[model samples]
Target: MPAPERIPSRGLTDTELLTLLAEGRLTVLGQVRGASNAVLHCTVAYEGEERTCVYKPVAGEQPLWDFPDGTLAQREVAAYEVSEATGWGLVPPTVLRDGPYGQGMCQLWIETPGGGTEPSLLALVESEEPGEGWKAVGFAEVGEGRTALLVHADDPRLRRLAVLDAVINNGDRKGGHLLPAPGGRLYGIDHGVTFNADDKLRTLLWGWAGEPLTSEAVEALGLLAAELAPGAALATRLAELITRAEVEALRGRVAGLRTAGRHPEPSGAWPAIPWPPV
Candidate 1:
């Protein structure tokens, strides 16, 4: 069944969500196993196929007052593309479509496998147990085939994500946002406050006081640097999504880090990043 031609801004409520599903309005096959804010995940039949999708049906103009930026709804799509462009398809694939709920968006649902829980990169490396390290990720539900984000300690993927987070100045890299897929594939989400030029390093992942930078790691940084040179297409594309100021500020930080050859360390006295990101 085709979606209604136009879904209102306020998006779908649970009742309508089910109604549409029953009538083959959009073929929602199963119940919502997990949800947060205005998002829900359910199994559905679409185009003669059984699939599950995460539905984000935002109410119109009722933007997340807490974060208060309407542009994020627009940016999430672009960010997915950016990660794909950067040779990191670890991110989720998305399908922006009308919802059975509010102004709906359908993203391909990625099932968290029963392969243990998401590892906490912070805990994996923090043998020092120095201070409050990135807390242990919840795996109870995950390993039991329930829904939850995952991450791990000692994972090279988290290291790469940390670098990418710093580069993007992602302000929302909470423990829960780092979803680890079935077989050790890690993915980051909730990038609403990203692309800021300022220092937005508010995450819980680091080891040995964030320690000295490794040579191989620096090589990856160098690789990214070389890829983002002036007139570089990737950098140019990023410039369009975020303000030129934000992009330039990001470039400066990357350059400085490359020059210094270091993993980022906390400098200011700001408290740790909040978990679950509202």
Candidate 2:
């Protein structure tokens, strides 16, 4: 069945956006390249106002031996639910819905700073020199037998995102997933490959390893743990999306993070950073 013909206005608040996305008419604008799945840049309109959103359709998902098929879209929505329940707001508003193609995950789009008149809030660039104000995360082999310094903004938002990734057990936190919005706000996207039962966290934000977690970060972890308690809202919602064992694993991660009280150190069992860092 197609989505409903009428949707609420685009004047939706963050909370309201979720409801609209679940039932709104989705129009695909174009394809977002470089994604493993079929990711479409889409516009969801209702009552003459429109908003941009990224839609990841499940039917287009490539089979993975590690992750279950047709469940990535649900995981994306689950990530957003966790972020909101913990009061972190690190992820943009996301929801599982029936789109133009089929069932998929739709996330509210955020404008990249400096797209026009706005000054650039964040920029991802590579330079030969690893200058100050920039933190060298890893080395990338640029073509022509040259090594390039891959650096990221040394911003507090990036730090918070690292903590969020740890708690979620994100397996693929690529540099391209970090979007810097206005006012130093950082939004983490592409959460389709997260919350696995095993330790699959691969990311680029290893600069804070062994550092003590901030007091606020600790509190957020506590909140997430509480939200996953038996009969908790997030637990109930997650059960509908993922398996029971996965939810238990998520709880375990929260407990582990709380016990450590510091940023995670790479276990060395797997690659610390993902391939193609940026």
State which candidate has the highest TM-score. Answer: 2
Candidate 1 per-residue C-alpha lDDT over 1-278 given as tens digits, one digit per residue, 9 for 90 to 100 = 11112212135543343333333234455445334345565665633444456555555224544344334544454455455544555456543456566445455555565533354443323232323434333322334565443224655567667676766666676766676665556777766566655566676554323456555557656666765676887677665555677657767877877777666776575444545432
lDDT of each: 0.54, 0.77
23-78, model 2: which lDDT tens digit per residue? 66788889988877999999887665578889998988888888973389998988
Worst 10 residues of 2 by lDDT: 1-10
On lDDT, the leading prediction is 2
Q: Which regions in candidate 2 have their CA more than 4 angstroms from the true location? A: 1-11, 114-132, 143-148
lDDT of 1 at 223: 62
lDDT of 1 at 250: 65
lDDT of 2 at 127: 71
For candidate 2, the TM-score is 0.87
Give the total clashing residue pairs for model 2.
0
